[model samples]
Target chain A: MSGAKPKLTTSAMIASLAAEGHRTSGAPFGHALVALAQTRLDIVGMTADLAKYTDLHVFAAAYPDRFYQMGMAEQLLMGAAAGMAREGLVPFVTTYAVFAARRAYDFVCLAIAEEKLDVKICCALPGLTSGYGPSHQATEDIAIFRGMPNLVIVDPCDAFDIAQAVPAIAAYKGPVYMRLLRGQVPLLLDEYDYRFELGRAKLLRDGADVLVISSGLMTMRALEAAKRLEADRVGVAVLHTPTIKPLDEATILEHAAKPGRIVVVAENHSVNGGLGEAVAALLLRNRIAPPFHQIGLPDAFLAAGALPTLHDRYGISTTAVAERIKSWL
Target chain B: MADPSTVSRRSNVSLAQRAWRIRRNALRMAAVQGQGYIGQALGVADVLAVSYFHALRYRPEEPLWEGRDRFLLSVGHYAIALYAALIEAGIIPESELETYGTDDSRLPMSGMASYTPGMEISGGSLGQGLAIAVGVCLGLRRKNVNAFVVNLLSDGELDEGATWEAAMSAAHWRLDRLIALVDVNNQQADGPSSRVLGFEPLVAKWESFGWHAQRVDGNSIPALVAAFDAARALTEPRPRVILCDTRMACGVDFLERREKTHFLRVEPDEWDAALAALGEMPA
Candidate 1:
């Protein structure tokens, strides 16, 4: 949307995902957790050393006694959270999605998910949120966790979605793994007056030309792209699916089954085991094959660079999503 | 905090007799499946005996009592051992030992909390128990719930970096009510635990990690009672660990002399031999 922006710096690598001049909310997850902890006395917060980065420091500061800093050990973080949940306390744990998925996968699987504990694992930097390189990029987190049973996975669109999602995850009596949109997350869903359900997909906007099924920051980008596509006389629909696992198949089939619309699955994750593949498998199994296109990162380790340039290069930014849809049309 | 010595309803000899029963229960369960983690169960019997009879506080009829001290089995393979203790304490039915590790059985080869009452955490995946115990202790502290937490881990589990990480955090949090019983049987899946990864100066490692550490022969009922009492008596604002150096198949001479006894498939004839050995030990 920015036609004339200043020269982007390396700081852009870790800059807020919010577009310039867009409304943003700071630390929605941390603040929402603090709000939930007040009424739910059993609610406790925990994190590895990424509290400041994941914005859980807000909750930690507010509830000093209820917070547990488990150092930099992700395995221990997941295990301890599982343990806490066993003893009648609900633990909301935060860390980088990369560490939760890659580093402590077995711990989460055997300890939290298998036991069906009421532990909320909120991880930041899902997919390519960071520009620091492959190490910081959690491009395959969804793929890693999608196979784990008894885990409810969420990929909130922005700060407003996260704010609505925190309590929803806690209210549900089981283990959850949500992707956190930390510090200065974009607030787009609030414009639609959207209320997030634990496992529901919300169709924010509708059109006849194309239907964009998305989650995470890509949903925000898809909403932006829908507006940009309007100028080109293209009517685009944005279906925001925050809950990735146990997908809202009823709503998805209802929307995607609408006749004569090109179905596009966009995500801030790798092409492997993401929303694109998930939707594809769903549509295939249900015997409804629409003309499909996927806008996801390539199946490779992405290079380290400024997030803006990386987003455009990998075709996930608003400009890229719009351009790709227009060319397909 | 419940002072264990004050709450005891039995003497050391009674505790020893319970140990024999625990060992007998474990051997019976293993015989049901014709195989199990019998070596570890036999080795850690006395630790479990002291834990249920002395150090911990709980209602045998009510496994999920809110005031109950948690006994976490981090070495999930030792499910047979913990199940034996639970049965002795009247938490689980003694008759259920017949159905152990069988189809539609509450007892599985590995431990899971949902499968049985009094079984706190799902384990079998080593190196994760101490972390869960740390969390339980943290939760207890937050709720101002006066309950101690005990985590039983294997020496082989010490090789897991997560154990050390949780160990460090427990001490950092000054979880004075948390106690760890490490079954240092000197045996792991590969070989002797010390040679497997060298957790020697183990006491120093735990102390450096900010824990009050103690070592005892895990098989000796008197020594375990003393160690449990010491861990409970400590006023230090830090986590405590009782490193029980145990012999695999402690009371059974034939199995005890065997070099490799980690996961045993006891011959059909050895069940009688094992029960006979337990009968020989002084109660």
Candidate 2:
């Protein structure tokens, strides 16, 4: 899919993903939201003209009357969601990550987060997920939303996490911003039998050489990299931090406190203010600094290309992550 | 055509009196703060009075009643005005008026939904209220709840691009239950609204966006009452906007004529005179 049309619409992007044999995790979110709506009538879905792309079409198809199409207005999408929440209704707002973090930041900040409204802002195309370019790829969404008070940020690794997070965020009151994996997302964590608990970091594998702290798609890559690294006899432990805010510090510290362990934080976000900076700060504050390194995007706008090329170029692919860990070891 | 001067008919005398009390309550609250957005409060008092007393169907004691009509204060700085109206409507205690803008008071300097009981949104950031109103109306429609959403904004808010975005969506959604009350005091923080940003032909802007637009004397209790009635009675699937052309500090003659009254710093002696000008004296 390299050198494909750069300006494909969300639907066109999804079709391209299908052509490439990639499945979307948006299916689980849409399906889970619909299933939740079956028992909880207060669940309402909203989108900024990206329902089909974000897999909100599933919810729309299931409950057409309950879905609201707010054209291409991200600000109104957030503001309206906040307003709906004010009326004692839980609104699941879907849009691209860039639009939510960049275009509608203030609305999310003031109307939703300030009031601690129960608005679930689930955005697709988070961090380097889109091959389209910086416009579609939200590489710094976590950093942007990290500073916001009373907002729960989640970076789901696969379909299983996305499915469980939908009901979990709905049940837990207040505002939440979750990065979405759209259009044929790889199902990996379920193979590991991972159960996503909010604000809890899960230790998938334990090794002595290098401890890889990861979240979102980076975790999937880390898990794959660890398997390959095992063939090389490099002992690697993977700690997946799904919830970025209200981080599971005790769990992270317990795994990272060991001496002689190279602590590498992997993320699909920017090197600044993301999981890398967060873990670095935590280690520095706790005086548990091992030989630490961050594997993520550079602090700049990424070039446009296909997902495979971009992932390799940005050093987040399975092979790239494996090679980096091998070199560090 | 009805004469503008005698627009107050016999039937609207009670509404006019209610407007007067709202204005007095605002004056009292402004006195508590020593200084506040008293001019905008006075200008929008009649609209708030008609909204709470005549137009809206809210259970005053039960501020969060699901079946009640929602009134969003988009211009959060004008919270003093809404606080006065809420107190008059019994949604808030009359004693709390003295605690306005004080420490630990529910009534903050700006209108916040988390802080104030009756406030539908935290509206200090201008240009957010209408978009939120559109969302509320859409949510209400989905729930099969028959309720109106009245968004009260200032002329300065028109400068915000997001407000126009909401306007277009509200009309596109055919949200007849949404009512926008734009207080055109023609004054903003920087300078006059016209000087800062020209929003003239404001009614045409709304009508072109497919809303039932009406320009009314915001200070006239009769005009406000009729506009609210006409807005509610419209059966068309179009949003309604009552463009209220009002004088800042309207009820009191002296304050109404004062220049630079957007955020008035009332003198110690002037508080009593301002109250007296509204046909009341200090208690």
Candidate 3:
């Protein structure tokens, strides 16, 4: 074979995308997992032939003995993780959010959640992150997993939250379905000095004009929007909710109860049954309904395009979020 | 308690005696409710006896022992059969059989891991057990824990694609310690399993999937014992499957001869006659 070809940088490959200039936290899942595996001998990495995509290849390379490649079988992947959990092994299973929430929902329900097995389902491409259309994007993953009892749902904002969540969910006994932000995932939570506590929400910025509540990638956008709004004198409070299920109700109510503060729920998921609906229900039940609005994808199969176009079209991009908040104000 | 080797060395006569007790317990539990998957319980008694008494290495007192072999009941409706075996193995109390299918009873009509001791999985939906067994076997091997994973599923379960998926993975992983016992009772909810879903050439199917496959008379104590022995003796790095050919009702002649024994609802008067045919006095 000839000399190794120079690898194409992520920026060079997806140059037209909005994620070009931002510094990635460096595949937090793979790096954090590899670091975690060094200490926790029981932690085993598994994937359904998406190891490289889900960033489980990092763990696979570090500890080849512990990683299991279940091929393209999502059901088997989840079932095997459940089995490993039964045998006192903590299995960190990686796959696409669509496959985990849709393809292997029953296995996740019966084997892992129903049985309350200690299996961490860390899936990539949650919500509008993937531009590969409806088939690849898991826009309603949270909605699907929300109804499932005994399942901890985490939607990490960025690489820091993902890094923190890996160890946190691992230490917490039971099943967790964590949406991953893979590849060159942006780093944002560190700047805000945010720490991912399992079920609690983190208040990144405080403002009186609008309380911008968000999770996953939307939180990143919400923070960016908040900063831009400050220049325009639109005070926005950003409450980053990493844990969607067992949602941080106390903090949500505290922020929502404030007068003259418009409560806006932003998420990278579908408007139906995700953070928006969840917060709406919480507010409605608690009788703390301020001027409310939800910023998320429509209740339909998203169209295929690049990440930037999809985010802009779905109104989850930083620019879209800032403009929406400005228009509402 | 004797080791698995010593237990396996026990005569077929003793194993047959154990099978009779297991059948009687199932009968007792079913009679208490006046209905259950009695046919399945009675039919699978021989395999359960061979597994719990001879083939398996488990401490009945310590159900969660790490080194113990796991037995997953893939067919949830077969909870009666597993409960009977668990009772015989001393994992559960025999008195609990009276409270079968009752409120707050450990012996539910269907098997649930949360409620029942010695139940490896909460099997209800068909085709889930084999996949779980594959994972358990792989986990055990990784930990260097020498233990076998015995997955007991029905012929009806073969219709599930997940079962075939798991079969492929088990073989691909070379899990020699995994053994799948398919109870081909030929009965299911819709009707006969064959008509519901044709899983015939089942032996060839399993063999083609890279498993050491065999077919044996499930109700026959000697045959089941021999099959279990042969499966355990295979030193090759390949999973094993024992396709057990069994009738709906194996012990009670009346029930065995009855049509639609899948979910047999015996008359109150027939209870005594059924027990009498099995050489057991009705309490």
Candidate 4:
């Protein structure tokens, strides 16, 4: 019943751990979705009793009457959302990444994705964000959902991107599987004044020496790697793409085709069919031959660990990203 | 169609010919496709005939009307019965029935809302349609609308745990606006449901779950009309359930005689005989 911004914000914690300038994408997506619900009547929200965790509580608070609490039934949660969508209401159904990706894939496939209904499935804790071990980490989420047809997958990088992408999704007409980065997230993206477009990638920086292509939370690490590598006399340009599916082949190929430039695809997802596989497919189909390195988790289920320890263990840190780029060079 | 309460005031004799016509249409549709779940389809033809001809409040010209009582066929394989009933209801033409299951036909083997009219939900995955029907009930109830929800399910489909979860929720919420009719045809895809999952004492299960339950001979038009009329009569704080005990191939001679007619391929030679067997029989 009270609104108080804690002095110990997530951005403050990030400043203490990493540096003064870093951003998170979680809370902004929650806030933007609330603002979107004001003008868009069709936007209805539901969660599997994780309203606070997924940050959809923002929308729930504004439109309490429209929200449905499907109490931990992830499959029914998705099915109910699809049912509401079938009735011409745009339902934003939220749950953890593991449940949405693994437990309810068939329901999502048959009800929402295959039927081509307009259900916005917002999933929290993609990859190793939740170090609750294999049970919580959804490292294989992108691989599973990407193989399904007619589903738009978006992995926003920072708070600014989440805020922008939320309104974009409300405008989009088909089904979308969005990865959430919840809770007092960092604010590194406000520096670039980034904008979001579904299935369209953004070009953050342009450098012919090397192309660091990254999406989702990994884009933050890629930007840091670019800054650190600049001090070492290696010119690098970071291209931050929050949209993974219907990937920005024009921009990806544009940078990959640049003469004497090496491409490094970075993601928090697995090696197979993640952003790495998607971009690789795009390059191969276009015949844009370039030296490429995939920076992502190996083909194994990650065990439970601390969030920071997990990111480091999986080689998704800025240091590991810098090392991958150095090896390609 | 007339209001169910008003239709129930008349005797089932008025609907005898319509029930036979629905059964005849179901057999022909299956015969044209050379295959269908006609056994299950035939089993539910009487109820569908009563609902389409005399009970449900709907307009054939307006399938998506807001005031219509929603009817969802939860078991998608029994779409032959739904297609036949929809055609009889005038939501679709008799000519389009020939295109059922063909490459470009709206009437596929399973029900899809995008392809067909009057299909409230896309079904095939068992135990899915009832939950959506619950959603429809909740949606209409919230608006203070006096609409009813009816979902046709199979005994075999009860093996799905989601159906029980939805059943518990519907009864606990006292969804008087909702009703579940079980097509208890005994036989399933592999064998009898009794041998497969053993859904014995089905009426007791519904009673224990807090639903007003009853059993009726599903093949009898008069019995089906009366059972549904009884379901509509309840105004208490619990949903009602009708257990429809029926033979696998209720209306056809060849299909009913065979033990392996669950997913029968009605051969070209057997089509005319199957149609003739169901031609004049009052379902």
Candidate 5:
């Protein structure tokens, strides 16, 4: 009974991603933005009635005069963000990832990306991070926006990454689509003293048995999987690529080119357009064909359930990743 | 190099003269493409003329000056019209008009903010400009920059739900610096804008959204000038809107008589005739 785990509660459906005992940072994006805005007078925050959900309420409270509550219109939110960018204010736009990628795609494409405005589109509940099923799951957001010109995409892994990415994207000249991890984000990378660079991939752990190239929360999962796999003598190297677009090609090619390691692209997105295909294409183009594999969500609408069940079912959880890697080995 | 449009930026020229120049510039730009949103350009010429030549404060040399007033052309097809005004305002050189719609041309068929100097936002996707203007107004207020933002969207754009969303936001934010200009030319791709989806009681609808709405004949230079002036004169918390009821292919009599002028494709011989018709009022 002491060793056995408690039953997963309904709260697991919308619980924080932070594992028990591991330190969690409270709304890194919101806090970082509030700090960055103190000096950068042009930094403005905006949301489409998702302030509290996306953790923009923190910034809203800090700078009530600078925050714009655009209500439920995602198109208007993106359109307004683009407009604010044009007027020389860097707008951090927050909403559900599904809303930004699916609902207001054309607006984001034409207004922000096309114009190359300095608008930070940070959306909450990326991929299966939301257990609200297909309605909330932005499983195809990366695939949807991967082809857009002038858009630099970021998928941060933890609170540390989110905190660093806030000012980095703000300092960046053009448009950025960042998958935000809000509400007690895991401060995982801080253990490794990792710094978030805009387009560079960080190699968190070195292993000869397998190379796990991952982004977003999947990277955190990959790190955990790496630690567990180490006990089995199945060395798992985790490459944390927060920036999805302008794929840290040199770093990826360098790692994938290494022989004897089974290179697997693990992502929280669909197997379709997200980082998996991107890495596969990059490897193929470079002719660095190692024993390749991918651990990702299926190209289908996920069922409504607890996120832990969903992650395990979809084969993106830490245990699932470790099990899949062992099977591949 | 010696274009009157460039020189006309100086106040020596009358608004009527400036409007004439804008129409000519648009026609010339259309001549390059052979087919475009020419009817829209022609109809919206008066508004563009007033905006660039009178209402907006912008430096020809520095189009992105932070303090300058902004003009958002929501309808990208009306790039010919806005480009014409830009050329007249000396923002874009007259030589660029010759390359309109070409592969390497800065003056593409649609208005792109990145390509053009004074083009504030890339507008082709309708119903987005008003929202962008609302943002710009909010930004200006935040920076405490005393500059007005004019969003010129077509009547067809009113059919978009985002426009109404922006309308509500502008009022909610108390963005007095925002001015929405609706070019109610009553022509859309499918059919007439009114019949396509009638935004009837248009002024009343805008008023309901807490805007200072005004309906005026858009082709009349005097009417447009007065509306623009009245819009600026008000320092109220409510955003201002000028619903300009305009005629498609205005000034070009023979083209105006044609039913489908949404994307007017003038006959090869009629380009000169249209230009000539633009010169003299239909009498």
Candidate 6:
């Protein structure tokens, strides 16, 4: 089924790249960055040796002169980005989500966030996207970063969202932490004809019985759940909020304000402080009381497993979300 | 704002006075609070004084100037030193120094970038500042605009694995614009670093990581200035590390001799005696 747009799927984007035998996430970010480079000369890229994992090698390929390989140093990656911002040039820093969140948090906090530099800290494999287990999974990335001042967090839903969000974040003035959906991520938002906005939420579908407030690729699963719920004659609206930090409270409160509305926050992250908690806080603080069902991984560290198995095990799949909403109703 | 050429040659008098004041004010500030990191403040006073007063270019009126040299105080307990320097540098009013460690003061126990002006990075969590400093360096480099990135750390911070990771990365990228100053006061919170985690031959360790490393008598003004001057002269891609062998509480006699390294507590009577014994601030 065509999501916001039917022409492209996340897998199809990756499959096209993979079909040509390109192996790492670094290739795509780098390639797309170079494509962005032709039009934008002010664009520069830096990596903490996750260039291969984050696919920034594509940009590295096009602008070898502008690309800096900082080598396994996430702190320097952020510092360099800040330095570039100081010089009136835009810098796109790439790394694994875990390293950006856990390893180089202080640098990101000080050099970028505190200073309010226009640095793009784009990270790949956010949440359970990585099979490398708890160490690599950035389950607590949003939680740790949400409290940081002047940082805009973006958890794009699919390839189309990523493609749209990249230029969107580039145009943004302050620092940004974009949770990357790499490796031919699914294209769901385009199917709904949704447009990207930094702090706005996109209501993919309308429903009356329950509202699925989701972000990132899980919004796709929410769409699938909504379709399934439609067959059961239960209305499930999908509110896709790509920008998680400056959370679109207006959209959240509007949908959740209705009585008997079941708000299910689905995400590929841990339940603690992820989309589930963010949405709940927004509703509760705004006095928009609704029965909330937080569908996400538990508080504990998730173990290493296959992608399909991990999603099913974590209860973030379409079937699992549908079942949880059915039970909540 | 003056051109880069004129800015460097502007004046050393104010900066020199700033060094003296940073030392004097730091001691006085520590005396007011009854006890604080006087040793660190006194040790790195010259370098901090130089950076704030002369060597670095910044706008006091515009703290967020795009072309300003960045300073990250990795050893946050040394806020007294920074407060003294910032005041002398005109980043804040000298009157603010009265509220040094007080409740209402913008100055907190540790350095916070959010509250303080001219504080490039908020530091206190130990080894994290170097990493943050690296971020500033990368940011500046990406813009192709050459700006100095200086990080001041304690000798004890060498024990943190994160410091090494930042050092390795900085050296790998050949961040010549970046400079790291190790306040080798030989003391940690527990005691002298030798007793805690001995980083003996620390210069060699930095050299092994591909950095241009040097040692300086941190208390000597000429030596500190010369060391920094030489560091700025290097053209290689490697970052520079300056090992400052500073005496804990260099200007004060009593606190320098105390076994306590973290926080020093002097009796009311001894406080006056200590201040008097320290005498006039060095020129």
Better model by lDDT: candidate 1 vs candidate 6: 1
- Computed on C-alphas against the true complex, the DockQ of each candidate is 0.79, 0.71, 0.78, 0.43, 0.78, 0.42
DockQ: which is higher, 2 or 5? 5
Q: List the residue pairs that clash in candidate 1.
A: B76-B124
lDDT of 3 by residue, B87-110 (tens): 988889988989999999998988
Per-residue lDDT for B1-283 in model 4, tens only?
6643344325454566666767788878877778888878877887787777766777678788778888888788888899988887778899998888899899999998788999877788988866666666666665666777888899988998767767776775578978888988877778878888998899999999999998998878788888888888887878889888887777777788886546866678887898888766544
Instruction: Please provide, for model 1 over A1-329, each residue's C-alpha lDDT reduced to its tens digit, 9 standing for 90 to 100.
Output: 87887756655434688878999998999999899889999998889998898888998899998888899999989988987888789988989998999999999999999988899999988888887888889999999999999999999998889999999999999999999888888887888958999999999999999999999999989989999989989999999999999899999999999999999999999999988999999999999998999999999999787788889999999999999999998
Over B60-122, each residue of candidate 5 has an lDDT whose tens digit, in order, gives: 887877778888888888888888989988889998888999998898888888789888888
Candidate 5 Cα errors over 4 Å, as ranges: A1-9, B1-12, B280-283
TM-score of chain A of each: 0.97, 0.93, 0.94, 0.92, 0.96, 0.90
Model 3's chain B yields a TM-score of 0.94
Every candidate's fraction of true contacts kept comes to 0.85, 0.78, 0.72, 0.18, 0.87, 0.48
TM-score of each: 0.96, 0.93, 0.95, 0.91, 0.94, 0.85
The model with the greater DockQ, 1 or 6, is: 1
Q: After superposition, how far is residue B2 of candidate 1 from its true place, in Å?
A: 14
lDDT of 3 at A172: 96
lDDT (0 to 1) per candidate: 0.89, 0.87, 0.88, 0.80, 0.88, 0.77
Q: Give the DockQ-based CAPRI class for model 5.
A: medium
Across A1-329, the per-residue lDDT of candidate 2 in tens digits comes to: 58865652333353222223444454878888889999999999999999988889999999998898998999988999988887789999999999999999999999999989999999988888776777887889999999999999999888888888889889999999999876666776777757999999999888989999999988888988899999999999999999999799999998899887999999999998999999998988999979999999999999877676677788988889999998987
TM-score evaluated only on chain B, model 5: 0.94
Candidate 4: the clashing residue pairs are A23-A186, A23-A187, A23-A188, A24-A185, A24-A186, A24-A187, A26-A181, A133-A304
DockQ of candidate model 4: 0.43
**What are the runs in model 2 whose C-alpha is more than 4 Å off?**
A1-26, B1-13, B281-283
TM-score order, best first, reads 1, 3, 5, 2, 4, 6
Which regions in candidate 1 have their CA more than 4 angstroms from the true location?
A1-7, B1-8, B11-13, B280-283
TM-score of 4: 0.91
Per-residue lDDT over A1-329 for candidate 3, one digit per residue giving the tens place of the 0 to 100 score: 88886633322212222255666766789999998889999999999999988889999999999999998999999988999998899999999999999999999999889989999999988887766678887999999999999999999988888999999998999999999887778876787777889999989999989998899888888888999999999999999999999999999998889899999999988899999999999999999878899999999998876677667778988999999999997
What digit string (tens of lDDT, one per residue) describes model 6 on residues B66-184?
77777778788888888888877677787777778899788877898777987766677788777767666765766665878889998888998778888887876678988898989
